[model samples]
Target: MELFNQIFVDPFVTMYELPDLLLQTLWEGFVSGTLYSLIALGFVLIFKASSVFNFAQGIMVVFAALTLVGLHELGVPAYLALLLTLGVMYLLAFSVERLVLRHMVNQPDIILFMTTIGLTFILIGAGELVFGGEPKAMITEELGLPTGSSDWDVFGGIVIFQHIDIAAAVIAFLLILGLAIFFNKTRIGRALRAVADDHQAALSVGISLNQIWVIVWFAAGIVALATGIMWAAKSDVSFALQVVALKALPVLVLGGFTSIPGAIVGGLIIGFSEKLFDLYWGVPILGGGTESWFAFIVALLFLLYRPEGLFGEKHIERI
Candidate 1:
């Protein structure tokens, strides 16, 4: 009975007693979920266009951040560094499409996956050589992102909101909205969908597989840069940050590998549930530190019940 009370009753009691805390927790979760969705969005973009899992995406985030910071450290202006970083990403996309993906066209999925794994190592080595292995602070102020916090008094208590977190949320939302419009309303976007459906057919239709690959990869790079900046602002920029990027795996699984909106919804679910569980039950009963594995467990349950994900299309093929 005591365990049951601790498991279920106490959490609700705490929530009832502290609505402000609940709101605060929800806000933090929203911020986290939005960033996770951003990272997962990179994955979705690449996979949708090229059918490659792009395992290097995590490292790409770190690399993009490192490049921006490194350029700034070398005396480039922040905005200039950002533009240069974007140019670098575009070069990477073009090189990848021309050198690696073009040669690997029509190859087995495993081969493409393995190629991305190799790319991850190359980026890691390159990043280390270029930026060193030390963690770097984000140029948040230089980038003009908001700093400090605001307090909201509600339910007879205070809830603190970080300005940077608010910025992250808003930027993420706008990025998602823009991408949705681009995907649904642009000529290249239709070409991307066509290539996603069938590469051979798309090529037959003159969709330019090479151009699509470069565009999607470059788009993924842009997402990586944004994710890296936001995440580094919250913490520090380092190769270690790539591990956190793995959290997007669960986000992708929950949201659906190919659905943009599903990624957003899935990220929020994981973010909210992880924070809530850690605060209410994990720390109290499980001795804390549940956030690390919480999302994956939730993702596993989703996999078991709804492999197609919330917005993912169910595929039926004759066996």
Candidate 2:
């Protein structure tokens, strides 16, 4: 016990004693976690509608960011460039449905997953060729996002929070709300749910598979765009940003790949725990870089007890 205290427990106590920095770190983690959820939501939307895992969702984030910045670099207004980039994402949705989903309509899930993995390589090559492989500034000021920071005094300590982070958190919240409403309150949303429930049955009942695929992919595009903007504001837009997409795998595992609410809760859980662990234990024990792998490890441990996830549907298959 004494050895453990000397090595791990005492150091964490000293670190936690800094309430201001702890609060600030948690705030940052929460904001980042929300953005991760947005990206994961893209996977949820497409997976629900088409059962396609969309390995390209991460690169879609980078591609959207590049298109936005590229259009602005051509002298378009920031807002206009944003709108046009959205149009690009829609175009992608249209093309994907027409070219990929149409041909692979009745294919097995493994095949669809493979196709998406192939598509990811294609997107990576195309993005590098068209956008250049260098990291670019996100044009945060041009996008009209607030910058800088503010501080609040608590317990004689000042907690600093960034305005950009606050805006990102707010925007993520609104996006989640919009998606929730879209999934639960609208006609198209209902159609989406129906298709997810039974694709062959949906087609038999007169639902156009093409239209549903396009719409669901477009919704995913919207999610990709919002995630790109916030993440780009935080760090420069680059292929590196695509790696963050891997974070969504654990989020999906925790939230259930099919549940929107699951995505949100899972994202916050990963974000908070990773930050907490990194803050209190990473340095005193495992060096650092815990953020890179902590979420998956946590998810793996959780899976030992609940393989279906917190909100995933239970299986009732019987012979």
Candidate 3:
């Protein structure tokens, strides 16, 4: 007990003597939570529009990253590469709207989900063919983003922060803000809501279902690109990063497919709780590696209590 206390338990209990580490951990959790919310937003958008869960959003993240880097490798300027990447996403949106989705509009949700899974494979193979399977550096400083770290002395300990992390948090918050407005305060947004409510009824009206799909998919692509950039800044840009995107699943489960604010709040809750529990409990009491499934276990246990989710509409049987 004494050896365990000295090795694992005491390090965190002595956090008071290490206020900076505590502050740093909190900041990192917040940043991770924000990024998770962004990924969740992509899922929510397509789900609301078409009533199909877009399982391919993770690959979209990798696709966007590959697009950006592949363009740069071909002698395009960094800024131009970003612009061209957005154009590629836009073209993809249009093509899918005109091609695959137009044919599959009335398909079952399960079928649509499987289609997305297939699309994931397509994107993975295409990205690999275009960019090769290598981890590439993000053009952060080239994009004039902040770099290095800033430190503050708090209680005789330095609370250090990555400038890139701060930038990512700010950019993600702004992106969410923009999406909130687009969804809540626009004519097209109302049309989208109508489609979500009843696709056949929406078609009966003047709303162009195909156009709406393109817009929503392209919007999701933009978010994916942003996610790719921020994530690449932290790790390497690789197809393997799609695995990280899976973390957003528990976020959606805790949030609810239809609720945007729920995604954000749920992500923050999961993020902070995991960090706290893994640090204060898992490492000390258990033999670590708790992060692998900590969020899933919390989500599953919470789901037993509130199956419909905190923000999801209550499900009641109609007699």
Worst 10 residues of 3 by lDDT: 6-15
TM-scores, each model vs. reference = 0.99, 0.96, 0.94
Quick one: best lDDT, which candidate?
1
lDDT (10s digit) by residue, model 1, range 177-209: 888789878999999999989998999988999
Task: State which candidate, 1 or 2, has the greater lDDT.
Answer: 1
Local error of candidate 2 at residue 56 (angstroms): 0.5
Most accurate candidate by TM-score: 1
Clashing pairs in 3: none
Compose the digit string of candidate 3's lDDT tens values, residues 207-315.
9999889999999999999999999999889988898788888888888887788788878878887886777677766777888899899789779987766676676
Better of 2 and 3 by lDDT: 2
lDDT of 2 by residue, 1-319 (tens): 8668846677567656887777877887798789878888999999989878899999898889988988888899999999999899999999988888789978899999998898788888988898899888898898899999998997569888889989999999999999989889998888889899999888888888899899988889889888888998888989998898899999988988889998998888888889888877776678888888989998998788778778877778999
RMSD of each: 0.8, 1.5, 2.4
Q: Candidate 2 at residue 258, lDDT?
A: 89
Our model 1 lands, by Cα RMSD against the true structure, at 0.8
State the RMSD for candidate 2: 1.5
lDDT of 3 at 198: 87
